[model samples]
Structure formats: structure tokens, C-alpha cells
Target chain A: MDDKIKMKVQELLQSGKIKGFLGLRERHGQVGPYLFTDGDDLEGLVVGDRFKPGDSRYPLNKQLMKITRGDPSGCYGVLVRGCDERGLKTLFGSGQIKSEQVVPVGIACPQDLADACECLKPYPDERVAGEAAEPRSFATVAKVEAMELDERFRLWLAEFSKCIKCYGCRNICPMCYCSECTLENKDFGDIGSLPAENPVFHLTRAIHMAGRCIDCGLCNEVCPADIPLRTLYKKIADIVEEEFHCRPGYGSPETPPGLNIRGEELKH
Target chain B: MEYRTVLTTCTYCGCGCGLYLEVMDGRLVGTIPCKTNPVNEGKLCVKGWNVHEFVQSPKRLTRPLLRKNRELTPVSWDEALDFTAARLREIKEAHGSDSIAFLASAKVTNEENYLIQKFARAAVGTNNVDHCARL
Candidate 1:
């Protein structure tokens, strides 16, 4: 799988098809996102797996946006799994990054990663390696959905209480590109204060994440307090899907940012 | 065209949460938590996350400032250091060394912090050296 991805990247870089190939490289035993300009420098290129398959993943699309935000004309090849493809799609929908500027080198996620993520679609539209895994559902969201309103509130309060006001969830989000965040405003929850206002910070972000979050599970992974942030955002995604019939990232190559759900149609 | 993450320790506090500063085209772009670091275990506080912002902030202090006539005025490094030394001597002589405690910042390196405490203890003969991030 790694060899196939490497060869594809090599082809893209050597043929001058892409200005650079945005992917991961294993350096000093730590795999991280790197931009490969030279094809021969693909010595440590990887599919983000260090030990377990699909364990080590970075927000490559986020890096893509940061780099390409300055210059959008240059076409670059990016490594993407299902979740990353979704993030890129959402980013395209939001006009943060353009589809023309990017060529997604898609790789299907392994079943173990699929099952772990409880993903809806575990494969990208195009792929170089790995079989398309069976889609999964959000069990955590279902469990929360089954709870009573007050119980749910209390549970979220308990979860949110552990937040150290570390905007890891927001900072790490590929979709969050707002320069002037509402969270920073005085009207919103206390920004610097620890034990962030109950549900305010998370709820604000979750609301913003509506029709946006791609269920990367990065928030959950990076949270030091062990908050189930993805569950909250997943619930938001479910609402968006059920109500608007819109999924942010799932779209054909032609209609990349398929935001078919128009707010103008809402009667309420 | 050049993109790499330089592994470094967060200077915000002494917890020393390891992080990678993502540099793109010789510019600081963002920060990422080092996943393998035992200190943070892929976690960082708000300050650590936004550590790159202050580096490129327009409001950040670029030169030393000294209070002149109840107003801060930008001064040369030598002027600021000399003024600070003279004032320190006066304060130590008048009110004794304990009255002039040295406060160290977490934003500086450990070596700089050690210099501050040493300056307090040896020069001023005061053990009232304290750190902002002292536990």
C-alpha cells in the first residue's frame, strides 16, 4: 500500500503534474505531514501508519489550505483518506480551498480504522490502495440520543467540565478558518478562563460545525480531558443529514462541495 | 515549497508540552502536538496551540521600553539595561534586597530564567526570586 502511494506521488512529482505532493513522511520515528517537491525525496513517504494501520494521521488538507491560501493557482497532489476527502470537500464548499488547485491522492481506510471511526463511508471516490470497507454508523451518537434531555445535559456538562480552555478542537479543525472567531468575543464564553462555560464553548463550536464537521475524531484524540467532542458534532451531523438531507463531504467529483440544502427553503 | 514541523517544547509554561511548529516557506504557520511525547500525550493548552501567533503579531514588543516621565518610551538596549541596573542598586541600598524581588517569565529559555534568579540571589543578595509558572 505504501509502495503504491509512493509510486503515485513520485509520478505526480516527476511528471510535473503537481507542484508538490502533500503527504506524510516518517522522520525520527515520527510520521508527520510533509510536502514533497522532488520525486527522489520520497524515501520515507508513508500512508500515516506507524504501528497499527491508519493510526498516525495528520490534517493534510488543513496544511494544504494553509500553504495554498496564499497562492491558489498552483495544483498540488494531496494524500487523503475518506475523512480527509470529506474535510477537503467541506473546505471546497466553504470556499476555503479550490478543487482545481488540488488533486486528491485518495486511499481507502482499512476496516479496523473504519470500524473504529464508525464511519458512514470509509472509502474516497478514487483510491490507490486498500479495499473499500463496509460503512458503519455512530454508536456513540446513538447512545447519547437514547438518553433523556436532562441526563444528556448533565452528561455533556460533566464532559465539558474537563475542558482546559485549550482550543485544540477548534485549532485542529480543517474547516475552521475564521479569522475573527465569535469565541474570542466578550459576549461569548470566557476565553481564557479554565473550566470553560458549561456547553457554551463546545455548543458554539458544535453549532458552527453543523454542515461542516467531517467526523475526523481528531477532537476526541487531542482532548486531554477525554471529552467526547466527536459524539456531540456527530449528533449535529445527524441533525443536518436528517433535516436538510445534506452531508458536507459526500459528493461526486464534478459537484465536489454539494451543499444542496438551501437555507432559503426553510419555512420556519 | 518547503514545509516541515520542527519539534520543540512549549515555552508558555514549564509543563513543557512537546509540540511541532509547522513552518511553511520559512514562515510559521501553526502548531501541532507531538503525539509520542509522554508529557502531554498529544495535548496542549490554549497558549500552546496559539504559540505561533505571538511570533508574527504586530503588537508584539520588538525593542526594550523604559518609563520616562510616567510614560513608556522606546529605548536602546544599553540605556534600558543601565537604567534598570542603577534603579536596582538604589532600591537595594534604600529598601534592602528582599524589597526588590525578581520575577521570571515562562516565555524565555531556562538558561535566561536561571540568569534572572542568579541576578537576584548573587547581585542583589535576595532569595526572593520567583517564577510566573512556579508550582
Candidate 2:
């Protein structure tokens, strides 16, 4: 599978189809994000599956934004898993990146990762490598949903109290692209204090992820406090789906119902 | 048009978390935790996330300062060192060596910290030495 990917990337770069290919590279037994240009060292190119489950995964879309912002006119190719493809769709719909400016080389995730993430779609829209695994159901979300109102509140308080205000969950999220985050505002969330006034800090971020989170589970993986952030955001996703009939990153990047509100006073 | 990431260790505390400093056109832009690092596993604290800011901050002191007439004034290396030595000697003579205390920073090397403790115990004949990590 890696050989096939390397061949395709080499063809793209040699044929001038893309200025660069953003993918993972393995060197000295360490895997990291690398931009392969001119295909001089295609031997190092590999799909991002070297780590075990629950290990931290790099936000490839976040890196894509950096490359695109620097060179908007330049066309680039990026390796995408199912979650990455959805993130790209979100980015495209929000006008963060032009669809024509990027070419995604889709790769399907294995069953282990698919089950670990409890993803509904384990394969990208376009697949060039690996077979699509069976979609898994959200057991964690179900467990949280079964709790009573007060129990849920108490559980969340206990979980959030362990927070160190590190912002790892927010910083690792690819869809959180706001230059001025509301969490940083003194009025919304307290500053220079640990725990950040429980529920306020976590709830504010969870509300923001209502229509944006793609269920990659990266936030939960990157969190140092081992908070069940994925389950919290999954509940928000469910609410958006049930209330507004909007499934984020399901199809094209149409505006989610939360952002599509048309106030009568502002209607032209 | 040039961009790259250099792997380095965080200097905020004793944990020594690993991170990659993103550089573009020779300017430090951002920091990302090293995923392969055994210590952090791609998780960074608030201090590590803002490491790039302090590197080129305008508020950071660029030169040594000495107090002149109750006001801090920029001074040469020789003047600053001479002033520090003179003050330490006068304090040790008047109140005793125990009156002065030495504080070491985590940012310095282990050898440097060892030298600082040595200076406090052997040279000054006092054990009033500590490190910022303790605080």
C-alpha cells in the first residue's frame, strides 16, 4: 500500500500536477508530517498509521491550512483518511481553502482505528489504498446519554475539575480556526486559573464544536487530563443532527443549520 | 517560501517535554508537540504552547541593567558583574553570608546549577541556595 502511494505521489510531482504532497514521512524510526516535493526521497513516504490506538495523531488539515495560506495559488496534494476528507469538506464549505487548490489522496483506516474512533464512515469519498472497514457505533456516547440530568452534570463537573486549562483539546482541533477564540476572552472564561470555572470552559468549547467537530477523536487523544471530550462533542453533534437535520461533513460543505439562521429583520 | 520544523525540548520545567518549533523563512512562527516523544506524546501545556512568543518578545530584557539612583539603567557586562560582586560582598560582611540567598533557574544547565550551589556553600560559606523548580 505504501509503495503504491509513493508511486502515485512521484507521478503527481514529476508530472507537475501538484507543487507538493503533504504526507507522513518515516525517518530514524520517527514518523512526522513532511511535504514531499520533486520526489527525490519517496522512500520515506508512508501512510499515518504507524502509531497504536489512543496515540496522538497529527492534525493534517491544520498543516494543510498553513501550506495553503502561505501559497494560495499553488496546488498541493495531501494524504487523507476518512476524518481528514470530512475536515477538508468542512474547510472547503467554509471558504478556508479552495477545492481546486488541493487534491486529496484518500486512504481508508483499518478496523482497529475505525472501532477506536467509533466512526460512521471509515472510508473517504475517494479511496486509492486499503479496504473500507465496517462502521462502528458510539458506545461512549450511549453511556453518557443513559445518565440522568443531575448525574450527567455531576459527572461532567468532576471530569472538568481535573482540567489544567492547557487548551490541548482546542489547539489540536483542526476545525477550530478562529484567530480570536471566545475562550480567551476574560468575560467568557476566566484567565490565569486552573480548571477555568468548570462546565463554563468545557461547555463553551463544546457549543463551538456543535457544527464543526468531525468526530476524529483527536481532542480526546491529545487531552492530558484524560477527559471524555469526544463523548461530550458527540452529544452536541447528535443534538445538531436531531434538531436541525444537519450532519456535519456528511456530504458537501453546505452551511450547517446553526449558522444558516435567517433572522426576519435582516432578511432582504 | 521556505518552511520547516525543528525538533527541540521544552525548557519550562523539569519534565522536559519534547516539541517541534515551526520556522518559516528563518522566523519562529509556532510550536507543535512531538508525537513520537515518550514524555508528552503530542500533548503540551499552556506554557509550551506559548514558547514562541517569549523568544522574540519586545518585553524581554536584551541587556543587563544596574540600579543607578534608584532607577534601573542599562550597563555593560563588566559594570553589572562588578556591581553584583560588590553588593554581595558588602551584604556578607555586614549581616553574614546567611543573609544572601542564591536562586537557580530551570533554564540553566545542571552543571551551571551545581556551580551556583558550590558558590553558595564553599565560596560564601552558606547553605542558602535553592532552585526555582522548588517554588
TM-scores, in order shown? 0.89, 0.92
Error of 1 at A34 (Å): 1.6
Q: What does the lDDT read for residue A76 in candidate 1?
A: 91
Off by over 4 Å in 2: A27-29, A51-56, A256-268
Clashing pairs in model 1, backbone N/Cα/C closer than 3 A: none
Cα lDDT of model 1 overall?
0.82
lDDT of 1 by residue, A1-268 (tens): 8899999998888888799888888777566777888887799888876677666777788889876765556889999999999988777666677788898999999898898899999889889988899999999888988999999999999989988888888877777777778888888866667778887888988998888788988888888889999889989998888876777788642332334322221111
Which numbered prediction scores highest in DockQ against the true structure?
A: 1
Query: How many angstroms is residue B87 displaced in model 1 relative to the true structure, after the best TM-score fit?
Result: 3.0
Q: How many backbone clashes does candidate 2 have?
A: 0
Give Cα-based local distance difference scores for all models.
Answer: 0.82, 0.82
- The Cα error of candidate 2 at residue B16, in Å, is 0.8
**How would you encode candidate 2's per-residue C-alpha lDDT over B16-92 as one tens digit per residue?**
88887777667787787777788888789999988877888999999999888999999999999998998899999
